[model samples]
Target: MSNSPAQDTLAQDFVAFAVESRVLRFGEFKTKAGRLSPYFFNAGLFDDGAKLGRLAEFYARRLVASGLQFDMLFGPAYKGITLAAAVSIELARLGQNKPFAYNRKEAKDHGEGGTLVGAPVQGRVLIIDDVISAGTSVRESIEMIKAAGATPCGVTIALDRQEKATVTTATGPQEAAESAVQQVQGQYGLPVVAIATLADLMGFLDVQSDAALVSARPAVQAYRQRYGV
Candidate 1:
């Protein structure tokens, strides 16, 4: 596919519609780190088939636009599994002819048993997911991908919070997570890419001109101040 108009449209929607729509509740949320966060972009809220389908289309568009050339798309178990199925279908719809696979949390004992389900993975693999918080899952995924005998080419996700610090340290969990991304890329030669960053979501909130958004502007700004790398 030669990156045509339709491709461009989908890429745009990936950032504006799919990614942005997911940023909900720009309010005080006690995060996993025990920090009071002003906003959250929970991909888990897309709890229906239609929303997931749209999300997949955008993900496929982003993968194409970002020039992530992969023979197989690997989604981690559970959430990744659903995302993988939807994205594979969207990619097919977009004429990408891509195959996708995901793993089980535990390997099945009977039938065609394996940790991984769906198509066989081969060549450079792209690991897809909703977000990257601490990157514990990402590292685990790398190991799993390697065990499956496919080289990880890249990692793609919907949103990048860009708040690379999550604790009181000079560098916190978010920093550590970003450091992990760089380290993975540097050590393993794999690139971790995202559709939109924290700034994009903040911008989207600002443009709405709503009071909730207006108030959130400051908290998000403070978040960037405190956590930004």
Candidate 2:
């Protein structure tokens, strides 16, 4: 869970911003994996112009700091569309301009007449997204990038839950040894970077004085101990 000093600072700051923006909430929330999580992070809640722009800056900063060389960016459908556009803008503002593209959920019948929009998929492409749970979006994106003959260099996400990935079998759900992010890295042999993680959230709680925020730490810790990777 250790990060470089720059990454540590950014993760802390991003966690604070997320809390203030109400994108991250501490409570009993149901996860897609059917677990009751102590906290929830909704990237879609970063809806306003200022908030979205700041979120993009965090992404750009993390990607740039990671030293991952990417020719362009590719965003999967839905959530990623906005992230890719805004991050591309912020990276350009930071003087590392790069072409970015996104896929539509369905193919367009007319006009450009394809699933992909913006610049053509080419070269080493970085996939931007909010987080990896099941990693369905990342899988789809990798297929698209490879279909276009582009190498999927890496993936940059806003947060890493750092919990075990799950699978369904005859007995029901079972936890995997690797988290979703770890699975992606192993399966594709590509690096995965995150701006913040569950560890960073716990770290934030450890240093905070607010009783309300600090009180949630026990539940979060319990959850991590039980299910975190």
Candidate 3:
């Protein structure tokens, strides 16, 4: 889908906010896949009330603007729990009230006696998450939603790394030559909407005069050229 000027501006603004909030940092950092990345984005760092509030606002705005249809929100266990709730509140504040639900990593033996929590998982559910590195969380969320009889319709994340994903096939592991977001969209037939992507980050840095950002551009660009989708 083509991004409107407003969407482009939001992407730029989100990149700026992430840097200012220190959620997106420039430095040598190792990913779970052991790739040395020039930059790191830790959504967990948006821990405080204020930062989370703003983060939710960004998610809400992006989802609303994307025009993805959904009847409810579903957050996976752990980080997604907070993300789903916060984004739901923010969406309601923006005049869209939707039911939100999440699952527990381990099902309870008492009380609710199940994994599902919050509002019942229902209708076309949109999954809210920080990022989709390996697509593990997304898979789990999809399963949970399906088990609850809800359709997994869309996913909204803070950023899209836009790097190729490795998948294990009958022949063995091989690069998918597509980003995790792309794979999710293809495999599940669902749209993955991200607030920004590696390309957007590059664009954000392009117009910046900050010496640090300018200096880091080369490394980020090289990394993208080598691993980007």
Best candidate according to lDDT: 2
lDDT (0 to 1) per candidate? 0.72, 0.94, 0.92
Where does model 3 exceed 4 Å of error? 169-173
- TM-score for each candidate, following the candidate numbering: 0.84, 0.98, 0.97
Candidate 3: lDDT over CA atoms? 0.92
Candidate 2 structure quality by residue, lDDT tens digits, 59-162: 99998888889999998989999999999999999999999999998999999898999999999999999999998999999999999899999999999999
Off by more than 4 A, model 2 = none
In model 1, where do residues sit more than 4 Å from their true spots?
A: 1-23, 165-184
lDDT of 2: 0.94
Task: Give the alpha carbon lDDT tens digit for every residue of 111-198 in model 3.
Answer: 9789899998888999999999889999988988898898999899999999988777899767778888998999999999999989
CA RMSD per model (angstroms): 4.0, 1.1, 1.3
Clashes of 1: 1
Better of 1 and 3 by lDDT: 3
Please report the candidate that would top TM-score against the real structure.
2
Kindly state the number of residue pairs that clash in model 2: 0
By how many angstroms RMSD does model 3 differ from the true structure? 1.3
Which model is ahead, 2 or 3, in terms of TM-score?
2
